[model samples]
Target: MKQLLEILGFIALVQGVAGLVHEFTDWDWGFVQRLDVLDGYEVYASVALLVLGCALLAAAESRASR
Candidate 1:
């Protein structure tokens, strides 16, 4: 369970970082306009997932430590 949570957290963290970069650096969004809404949503989702995954990982780790 701990390992699973850690893996999920890592995945979410990485994905969130990617989404954040995409939101900030992607050029298409600046010009295309549609990328704005799409990337914004992706960023939000990724951030939420990241938080949830990290929480799960922490809970699992705490349980394992016990």
Candidate 2:
């Protein structure tokens, strides 16, 4: 479970980074402007996933330590 969570976190982080790249390359709107409606969503979701995954991994680790 811990390993799974870690993997998920890594995936999320990578996806978030990709989203950021997409947003940066998008010229339809200026940076920090309307980005949230576009690729920014990916960033947000991926960040959330990463945080959740990390937390899960931490919990698993703690449990294993017991």
Candidate 3:
């Protein structure tokens, strides 16, 4: 279960990074079409995802320390 959380957190981190990249650049993630179509709100969503992923990572850290 813990490993699952770690993997999910990693995925969220990667997606957040990808979202940021989409905001600044013109990169696509294969199936996530419409990379060129976005609003300003995407940045906020990306940051939120990043924060959530970091929080999950921190949770994992505490678990590991135990």
Best by lDDT: 3
Candidate 2 per-residue lDDT over residues 1-66, each given as its tens digit? 667766665665555555456556753422323444644365565456556656766776786776
Give TM per candidate: 0.66, 0.47, 0.77
lDDT: which is higher, 1 or 3? 3
TM for candidate 1 is 0.66
Off by over 4 Å in 1: 27-40
lDDT of each: 0.66, 0.56, 0.72
Candidate No. with top TM-score: 3
Better of 1 and 2 by lDDT: 1
Over 3-51, each residue of candidate 1 has an lDDT whose tens digit, in order, gives: 8878877776766666666667873322222444655477676577668
> How high a TM-score does candidate 2 get?
0.47
In model 2, the Cα lDDT at residue 57 comes to 64
Q: What tens digits encode model 3's per-residue C-alpha lDDT throughout 6-64?
A: 88788878888877887689686521234445455677777777888898887877788
